[model samples]
Target: MTSTLLSAIPRELDVGTRRSAAIAQFISTARQLIGDPSQASREDLEAVARHLETLGRQATLFPEEDFPVDQEHPAVVYRLSEEADGGFALYLSAALPGKSVLPHDHTTWAIISGVQGVERNVFYRRDKTADPARDALTPERTVDVGLGNSVILGPDDVHTIELQGHQTGLHLHFYGRGLDHMPARVVFESRAGGSYRTFGPPAGIRHARITPQDLKAALADGQEIALLDVRDAGVYARSHLLFAVSAPRWRLPLDIDRLVPRRNTRIVVIDGDESQAHDGAHQLIRLGWTNVSVLAGGTEAWAAAGLEVFSGTNVPSKAFGEVIEHEKQTPWITSEELERLVRQGDNIAVVDSRTPEEFAAFSLPFAHSVPGAELVYRIAEIAPDPETLVVVNCAGRTRSIVGAQTLIDAGIPNRVVSLRNGTMDWLLTGRTLAHGRQTPLPEPSAGHLAGARAQADAVAHRAGVRRIDAATLQRWQESARQQQRTLYLFDIRTRAEYEAGHLEGWRWAPGGQLVQATDEYAATRGARIVLADWDGVRALTTGAWLAQLGWDVSVHAPATHGPGAARVTGPEPVRVLVPDSPAPLIAPAQAAALQQSGAAVLIDIDSRAAYEKRHPAGARFVAPGRLSEFIPTLPAQASVVLISADGILAHSVASGLLRSAKPAQPLLALRGGTRGWIAAELPTDSGGDGVVTGDDDQSYSPYLQKDLALRNAGFVEYLEWELGLVAQLEREGHTGIALID
Candidate 1:
C-alpha cells in the first residue's frame, strides 16, 4: 500500500518545483482527515502520519541546503501555520547528527515522518503503580525512523529522540494544536532508587508566529506587545522591524528577567531565521512567560508586507533621551568647546559616568571615572569648588543626560552640563579620545559631605521616595520569603567600593546604569527594592528614580554595616550540586602528570574566545552543548578531564557524560578548572587550532568586526536606529514605559 502511494508521485518532476505544492496537499489532506485537531483520535492521527511519510520520501527531491540546521541550536523549524489554540500545526524540522533530546511528552497528539538520515526514537510507558504526583517512566521499545518511515504518538506518549549517523536528519511533523502553546507537557527524569520525577512544564507556551498584517492590526488597535529582535546588536543596528528592541539571542536568557519583568506581557520575537525565533519562543516559554510569539518570516517578511523597519540598539532609551533634551532643554557643551576650555586651563572638571572599563577604554581629557551610581556620592570630591564647572559624559547620550540631570536634581552648586551626544558626537566632530587614564576623585571634606546629604534628602522627598529603617527592611525580606515575592537589595556604589565592604545580602549595581538598564537588575515589576550606600546621597538619588519608575522603593539612610563589616571580596560563586561521581577529580599538577603519561584528554568548555586566549596545554575547546558530538571523536581509552573557567560547569558536563547510554571513557572535572591550572604555574596555549569541535554558541557581531568600514557603518546605523524609537513606541502603544521629566 505504501509502495502504491510512492508510485503516485511524478517520476520526472523536479523536487524544488513540486515540494511546496506537495506539502500543501499533505496539509490539506491531514486537515480533512483530522478536522479539529484537538479532537483527533488515535486512528485519525495515525492516518495523517502515514500520509506524512509519503510526503517525507519526496524530501530527497528538494535541495538539502534549503533545510540547513543551525549548529548552535541544532534544529531548524519551518512553521507552516499560525494556529496555536487547539488548532492544527505543521512544521518541518531539521537537526544535525548526534543530537540527543531529553524524554518529553507532547500535550497534544503528534505525528512525525522522517525524510533524511536516521532518527532513533525511544518510547517509554508510565508506570501506573507509582504515586500520581510522582511519575515513573519505563522504557518500552525503540524504533529506527528512516526515510519514508513514520511514527504517531498519542497525547499521553512519552519519548526521546537521538539523531543517528554523521548526516543531518529532516522530518515533517504535524501536531494536534501547536507545541508552543502546550505548557502542560512533561519532561520525565529518572531519579535515584528506580523512581521517576516529572518536571513541570515551562511557565507558558507561546504561539509559534505572527503575520506582519496581524501585528500591524494589533498595533493599530493599540494592543500591548513587546516586539523583540533576538539578533546581535550589529544585525539589529543594520535593520529591524519597527518597535523591535535589540535583545541578542545568546544574552536573552540573562537579560529577559529585567527586560520583560511582567511575565504576562505579550512578547513577539523577531529574527532572520525561523530557528532563532522558534528557539527564542521556547526559551521564553521555559522561563514562564505567558504570551509570546515569533514574527512570521522576520524583518524580511515584514518588509515584503510593506511595513517599515529601523536600525540600532536601545532605540527607545535613546529616543527618550532626545525627548528629555528637547523638552527640558538639558544643559550641554560641545566637545570642541570643552576641549578649548580645558586647554585654556579653565576651572572645569570632566566626569565619565560609564563603567570603569568603558571609561578606561576612552574618555575626554582629564575625565575621572565616577560611574553614574557614584556621581551623587563622589560629586563633592569630584568638583569641590562650587565655582568649578562640572561636565558629565558617557559613550552616548542616555547616561550623560541621566547623570547630568541627576546632579541637577540634587541641587549641586557647580555649573553642570552634559557633553551633547557624548563620545560618538565627539568622534564625529574630529576630537581625540584620552585612553587608559585612572584619575580618582579627591577626598570629600566634612562640609562637602553635609551639603550632598542635604541635597539628596530634598531630591528624594520631591520624588516621593521612602526612607526605611533596618527593622522595616527585615520585615519586607521575611514577607518576600513567605509570599514567594521578589525583593532586591542593591548597594548603589562603585564595584571597588562594594567589593571592599557591603551588607551580606545586598548585590552591587551602579546607580546610573541601574536606572538606565533597570531590566537587567529587576525582573519583577512590583517587587520591593531597597538601595543602600555608605552615605545616603547615592541611595537617595537612585531610589528617587526607582520611585518615579513605579517601583516600591526605599532608601536605607544609615549604613546597616559600616565599611568592611560583613564584607566579601569578588562576586558570589555559582555552585550546582550534581550526583556524587565515582570518577576521581585531579588537581592541576596531577592532571599535568597524567597528560605527560598520555592518559589524559582535557576538554575545555569555556567560551571559544576565552579558550583561544589561553587554555591548558593540549586542551581541546568544545562547547558543553556539543559535547555529545565531540565525544565519539575522542581517543577511546584516554581519561577525559573536563575544565571550564570554574569547576561548576565542568562538574555539570561530567555528570551529563556519566548519564549517557554509551559512556566512552571515565570523565573527571579539573579541581578548580583553568584558573587553578594557571595558578599552579602550568603552561598554556593560544589560538583556534586547539578547537576540536565546531564553536556555534558564540555569534560574530558586525560592530566588533575588524573591518573599519563595517564598524563605522554599524555606528552610523545605530544612531538612526535610536532616533526612530520614540515614534515606534508611540505607534506600538507601549503604555508600560514612561519617561520622567
Candidate 2:
C-alpha cells in the first residue's frame, strides 16, 4: 500500500464483488434466509459494522441547495448512504439557534457521536393517557432533564439535545440499516376523533448520487500531486479519474481518532468535476492531508482530461450470513422455565420488560413487570443476587435481549441470558404456560436510569426477530392484492396452527434462520413486511424492530379475546388524504365514502411509483422517502389510492403496506388510473416519467439537487452529502461538533 499523510488507514484492500458480498446471494440465497426488516442476526450486524470499518479515500463533499430554514443557526444536514438493516448511517450535521425539534424519537437505535460541538440532551415519552390525536405539539410542555452535558450519542440510547447555538454542530450518526429504510415512520397527526392518524409505508427511499460539482478543488498553482477519492464504488464507477481508487467514506469515522501516518501527502479528492473538495481537503488538512490540494476539477476534470476510469465494481461491506448457519438464541424465556428457576430457588431475577398490560394478563411464572423504562433501579430489589443469573424475557427476544444486555453492559454482576427461544421455545417444548403478574420492585432511581442507559449500548444489537398480531394476519387474508404491498406473513409458530388456524396467506418463518435471514418478508424496499408470532410479545417487539427502520409499522397488539385472537381491523386500513385534490379522481362516490369514514385517506392514486417504468397516466412514484409521512395529512376513512398498475398491485400490497403504514382504509385501486382516462380516454399529461423533468419545483426530490444531471453521482454529491446531513441532525440532533470550527 502506498503511504500517505492521512493516517488510521484500514489494513488490506477489502475486495469482493456485489454477488459475493450478499449475505447468501442478494437475491437467491438471501431470499431463503432473510425474514423481514425486523430480523437479522446480531452477528451479521456486528460483522457489517466490522466490514464498514475498512478504510477508504476521504469522501468528496459536494455543493447543493441548503434546506430552507429561517433560523440563522438552522439545523441543516446532508445524508450519505444508509446501513444494511435500515437506519440512517452516513450524514453530517449543522445546528440551529433555538428549539431543535418537537420531541420525537428515531425509529431505531443510533450513535450520536459529537463530530463538532457540545450539546444538551433532553428526552420525552408519549403521555400514555393523553389522546394521541389531541396531543398538540404545544399542548404538552417538555420535561427538561439533564444527562450530564455532552455532545455525544452512543448507538443505543435515544436522546434529544439542544445546541447551545454558539456555532455549527456536527454529529456522526449510525442507524439500524439505512435512513430511508426505517419502518412504520408515520408522521404524527391529530384527527378530529382525537387519535393519531398514520400515513403510508415507506415506498422507495432515495439513493445518494455524486456529481462533478460535489467535488472540492484545492488547487496548488498547477497541481502536480496525488489525488485520493474516498467515495463508494457506485460513485466511482458512474464516473471517476483513472488514477483514483476507492477509499470509502468510512475513513473519518473508524480511523481519524488515531493517526494520519505521514506528512507532505497531497491528498486530493476525485469526486468528479464540480464542487470544491475543500471540506474533505479541510478535514484531511486537519488530519494532516499535508499539502493536500483537491484536483482542479476532481475526477470529472480528470476524466474529461480523457483519463482512464473504472465502474461496475463493488466495495466490500460486512459479510451477511455470520449468524444464518448458527443456532439463534431465543430472545426470551419460557413461563415454565421461569417457574422452575423461581421454584428451584435459583438466584435468577426474571424481569418482564414488556408493557404493563402484557405483563398483567399473562406472564411467565414469576417474572415482574419491570417494563423497559423501569429495568435499571428495580434490579437489586428484584434480583438482589448480583451473582445470580438475571434473566430478562419479553414474549420473544428483541426487547428481552436488549433489556438483558442493558444489565450486562451496566456491569451488573449477573449472567444475562435471554431465554433461548423465549416463551415460544418453552411452549414448543410442551411446557404449559403459567400466567400471573409480578409486582414492581420500586419506582427506580438515577442509578437505574444510568444502568439502563449503559445497557442501551446494546440497543443497536439487531437480534434476529419479526412479529405480527392475529388481527393483522387476518386482515392480510382479506382483499389481498397482487403486487403493490404484499405482506408475506411468516408464522414462526408450529406448522399445525399454521396449517389449521393460521391466517390464510401466512407462510412459516421458523425461529431458526429468521435471525441470520432478513430478506424473506418485506424484501422490496417498497413492500410492507409483516411477521406473526402466535406467541404474542414476540410480534410486538419484532414489529418494534421493523418500526425502528422508519418504515410504516405496527404489530397486531392482539386482544385477549381468544380463538379469532387476531381481529381484522376494518375501516381505514391505510388512509392518505391529499392536502388538495390535484389528481382527477375525486369522484362523488369516493368523496362521499371518504367523508363518512374515520380514516379516509386521500392521495393522488396517480401520485408516485407506477409511472417510473413507463405507465399510462395518473400514477407517479411517491416522492422518495415520503410515501408514509404525507399519508396522515389525508382523511383517515378513505383508502390510500394507487392509480398505477391499474390499481391491482397497490391493493395486494395494502395489507403488508399497512404493516408499516399502520391502520388505514384498505387501498382503493383507481381503475385505468390516469391512463384509463386518457384511454377511455380522458385528458392527462406527464407528472414525470422517471426522468429529470424540470426545476419548476413540482418535479423534484427535495433531497435532489435542482440541476443535477448525473443521477447516481448527483444524488451522492447533492442529496446525500449536502441535504442529507442537514436533515440528519434534525433527527438525531446536534450538540457537540460545533467546536471543530
Candidate 3:
C-alpha cells in the first residue's frame, strides 16, 4: 500500500524546486538544533557544516545552467531563499577561474559548501602585537573546499576566497542574516596595516534593459511607471525626459525607498549613458525593489531617438498647462494687452497664482497674491462685481493657465483670462517687476465658502475624483499596509495653515505645488493619494488635477470641531538614513569651545553659495561627496566638526566619512548644526572666503541666475518648451493626460 501511494505522486520535480526543498529542510533542522544562530556554539557550527556537506553532495540539484559567470563579472551571486525577516538567508554563487576576493569579515556567522570546482579559502586573524590604530592581519590557516567539502565561520571570522581550478566554481552560501542588512561588514585592502572600508549595500543585479522606444511605449500604456533620471540635480536640470524624476545615484539610498514605495512597481533608471543607470538599478534591487530596469542607452539614447528632452524641473506640469490652453482655448491677455488695460484703468483684478514668497520677490503691476488653489476660493471676493475681469499669472505659464481655467471650470461669473506667458513675458518685454511687496489673500466670507465648496466638488466629480469619509480613509490605510501597497496622505492647504495644524500623519503639500511637482512629493508612480483640508474646496480642486494626471486620488474634509478635528502642529521633520558607524555628535557649546582653543576644525558641507553667504568664522566649505579626500588633509590632532543648515546633513556627512576609514583626526558632527551655533550667539563670516569648493553641488533656477542674458534666454527657452509640449505629446505618446472640459 505504501509503494502504491508513493508511485501515485509525480517523480519529475524540477531541479530548482528540489534544491529549494532541500534548503528548507536544512534550515528547519538547523533551527530545531540551534534556535538562535547568533548564539550558536562550536558544536552547532560543526553540525550545520555537516548538513552543508550533505547539500554539496547533491550534484543534480546544483545544476550548471542555474549559475553563469562572464568576463565583466568574474563571480555572480544568486539569492536562493531567505526568512521573511531576512534571517537564515541562503545563496548560490558561481565564479570563474582566477577570480579573487579581498579579505573581508562577515558581520554574522556564515557557512559555505562547494558543489563544483575547487575554491581556496585563506583564513586570517587580527595580529595582537600590531599597533591598535592600524589594521593588521596574520595568516591563520587555509582550506581547499571541493565537491564534498564545507567551511564554517563565526561572526568575526575573516577570510579570503580564490578560484584556483580552471573550471567554473559553484558553491552554496548560508548566512545567519541576509547580506542586505550588514552595513557594518568590513573589508581590508591589504594584509599589513592597510586601510579598511565597510561593505556598502550590494549594487549588482542582472536587470532587464529597455530602449528609449520601449520606454515610450510603456509611458503610452496605462500602467504606472517611474522613469528616474539618476544623474545629479545640476546635470539633470540641463536635460532629461519630461516625465523623469530627478533621483541622483548618490542620493538613492536616502530617496528611492520614499520615492518608489511599491517594491513591485516598474521603474527605469536613466543617465547620460547606461553606467549610472545600471548601478542605480542594482542598488534599487538591493533595497528590495523587484521590478527595476535600466534604460539601455539612457537620456542620450532618448535624444538619439529623435525625442525632445526638456530642461528645468516640473516639465510635465508645465507641458500639461500648454495642452490645457490649446484644448480649452482658454482666454489669454498678453503682457502688452494687460499693460494697456492697466493704463486705461479698466475694472480688472490681476492675481498672481504663485506663492506669497514668490509674489514678494517680484510681480506684475497691481497684482495680489492669490495662489492657484486659493484662486477658486477667493475669486468671488477678489472680484466682487460680476462684470469685473479676473486675470491670473505665474512666474511662467503653468499656474497661470491652471489657475485661470480652474475659475472658468467652476463657472465663476466673471471674464477669466491668463496673462500670456506670465511674468516671464513681462520681463522679456523689458518691464521691471514689483519687488518687496507682500500681498496676502483675505479669507472669503462664509457665503462665498459654501459656493466655492459646491463649485469645487462639481469640478472634482467631473474629473472622476472619488470622495471618501474619514472612516473609509482609515480602512484604506489599513488595507494598504496589509497588502504592502503604497499610500500617500497629503494636506493640500497653504504651507502656513498646514504647519499651524494638520492631520497627524499627513504631510504638508501646498495645493498648486503638489500638482506641479507630484514626483517630488510622492516618488511612487501608482500610489493611492488622499488629500485633505479644513473645507473640501482646496482638496477637491487639487484632486481634480491629480485625477486627470492619472492618480487614484480621493478628497477628504476633516470636521472643524468634532472627533475628527484632532491635528498636529509643527513642520514634518526630514527623514534620512545615516551610515552604520556614525560620528560622535558635539553640542554647540562644546564645538565652540574646541574651535576657540584651535583643537577643532569646522567643515561646512552646505551649498557653496550658502557657505559663502554665512558660515562659522573659520569653517571651510567641502562637498559631502568629496569629504573622504578632504578628511586626510586636516590636521592629525584636530577634531573635525561638520555642520550644515540643520545638523541632519552634518550627521549624514559624518556617517559617510566614518564608514570608509578610521580617521586619525577625531571626527564630530555638530549637534544642532549652524542654526544652533547662531542661536548660541556665535560669530559668523559672510562672503566667499570660506568656500573651498566649486559651486556645483546645488542647481540654480532661472530666477536665481546671475547672468541677465542667460536668465532671459532661459526664460525664452522655457516658454518655448512649454508651448511645444502639445505637439511633442501628439508626436511621441500620451502621459495619461486627459483633460476634463
Q: Considering every candidate listed, which one attains the maximal TM-score?
A: 3
Q: What is the C-alpha lDDT of each candidate?
A: 0.69, 0.39, 0.78
In angstroms, how far off is 299's CA in candidate 3?
A: 4.2
Work out candidate 3's RMSD over C-alphas: 7.4
TM-score of 3: 0.76
Sequence-dependent TM-score of model 2:
0.25
Segments in model 3 whose C-alpha atoms lie over 4 Å from true places: 1-37, 41-70, 76-108, 111-231, 248-309, 559-563, 587-601, 618-623, 626-640, 661-666, 688-695, 727-732
Could you give me the TM-score of model 1 versus the true structure? Answer: 0.58
Clashing pairs for model 3 are 259-523, 259-524
| Residue range 401-496, candidate 2, lDDT tens digits | 545644553456667766654554444455545655547446435665455434433332333223355555566545234211234454543333
Model 1 Cα lDDT, one tens digit per residue, 242-316: 457666644554466545545545577888754457656654554445456678778888878877665544444
- Determine which window of 10 residues in candidate 1 has minimal summed lDDT: 573-582
Candidate 3 lDDT over residue span 1-741, tens digit each: 122322332345434334544655677677876788778788887888878777777777666654556787778776655554567777777888987888888898888988888888899986544555457788899999888789888888889989986999988888888776588988888755266788864555333466778678777655557788876666677778878898866566577756766655667788877766765665565455555666867888999999878777777777778889999998999999999999999999999988888899898869999888888888888898989999999998999999999999999989999999899899889887989998868898999999999999899999998888878998888866663457788887888898898888788888888887787877656678998856868888988988887788988777788877898988975556442456799998899899999999998876777777788888988765456667899889999999988887677657655644567898889988888989988889877776665543556557766688998998987788788878877765656788997
Return the TM-score for each candidate structure: 0.58, 0.25, 0.76
Residue 191, candidate 2: alpha-carbon lDDT: 17
Best by lDDT: 3
Alpha-carbon error at 432 in model 1, in Å?
4.0
Clash pairs, model 1 backbone: 203-288, 237-312, 258-519, 311-721, 373-511, 373-512
